[model samples]
Target: MIAQVQKPIEEILEYLEGRDKVVLVGCGGCATVFHTGGEPEVKEMADILSRHGKEVLAAIAPPFGEFTCYAPWSSKRLSKYRQEIEECDAILMMTCGDGLQVVRESVIEGEFGLLKRIYPATNPTGHMGGGPALFKEKCQQCGECLLGKFAGICPLTQCTKGLLNGPCGGSQDGKCEADPERDCAWMLIYERLKKFGELDRLREAEPMLKDYSQMTRPRKIEVAPLVLE
Candidate 1:
């Protein structure tokens, strides 16, 4: 899951400068889970903007819920608010960068040039751990899975220094030197491998450098449709 934090109100105010009319677009997916871009947050932003003497034309959550990041779905959902969006000088998106980009694309596709000024109200922090309440950064989404070799532990993310081979010399008493409060990731991996009698695997091969090509920006995958002969 993507994790996000609300942008500072001062920054929001600066972004809203000279835009008297605005529309607030909230996300119901990860943003809602992180308490950043949910309906309540949208309403709160609207109230704050109103207090600042800005007219909030509308505060709405995409009808497609978690799929708001998809341009087609977002365009359809936003179409209902065409009048409100057109009348507004700018749109304040209470979501992560992806959602903001999707909304902006949707607006462009819909020929709503008046709503070209799009702003993000939240800053994406990182990919979060699984489950509803775990907002901790667990995965880096490197496009390569190395958990099999590390005994299910992610050295890249859990380790402060992102060491893949072993615990750094700075590790003292099983704690990381970079952050004394956190246990060393290599230590945890060592213990887990030792318990599973797979400690020998560590010496089997040298750790290879991460393949950054797999994590190139603007990455995408295509699923071919099935054709019956």
Candidate 2:
């Protein structure tokens, strides 16, 4: 999931300095999980904007599991607000950057064929895993899978320096020197490998270099449509 946090109200207000009519849209996916852009957040934002003298035409939020980043889902859900969307001077997107862009490019500009100023209210930190109580970044989406070689621990993400060959030799008492609050990633990997009797893999390894060319930005994929029985 994409982890995100809401931008400060001061910053959001600055973006609406000259705009009056506003439409607020919230996400039901990551933003909901992070308490950044859920239904309640959208209502709160609408009230806040109203108190600030900005007229809120509509406040819309998708149901949980309906991601605002998906073109079809967002377009369908937002179609009912076409009139309000067109009348609004600006849109306050209480979602991650992707959701904001999708709403602008796919829903507003593509479907409606009308250009409107859209602003993001949340800042995405990174793709992460773990939920219910907490979330932590687990992958960088580098377009390569090396977890099999490292006993499922990703050094590129967990290690401070993304060291692949071995530890940075700066850890003390199993704590990372760069980040004293966290245990050394390499130490964790070493312990895991030792427990599995796979320590020889580390000994026979050489320094590794990541092929970043595979990680070209704006990557896309085309998948076959799902067939329901």
TM-score on alpha carbons, each prediction: 0.88, 0.93
After superposition, the stretches of candidate 2 with alpha carbons farther than 4 Å from their true spots are: 204-207, 225-229
lDDT for 161 (candidate 2): 91
C-alpha lDDT score of every prediction, in listed order: 0.82, 0.90
Clashes of each: 0, 0
**Model 1 CA deviation exceeding 4 Å by range:** 63-65, 110-115, 130-134, 223-229
Q: lDDT, candidate 2, residue 94?
A: 92
For model 2, name the residue pairs that clash.
Answer: none
lDDT of 2 by residue, 1-229 (tens): 9899999999999999999999999988999998899999999999999999999999998889888988778888899999999999999999998899989998999999999999989889999999897888888888888788788899999999999886999999999999999989999999999999999889766447788877887877677744322
Which consecutive 10 residues in model 2 have the weakest lDDT in total? 220-229
Can you write out model 1's per-residue Cα lDDT over 143-172, one digit (the tens) per residue? 998899899999999999887777778999
Candidate 1 — what's its lDDT? 0.82
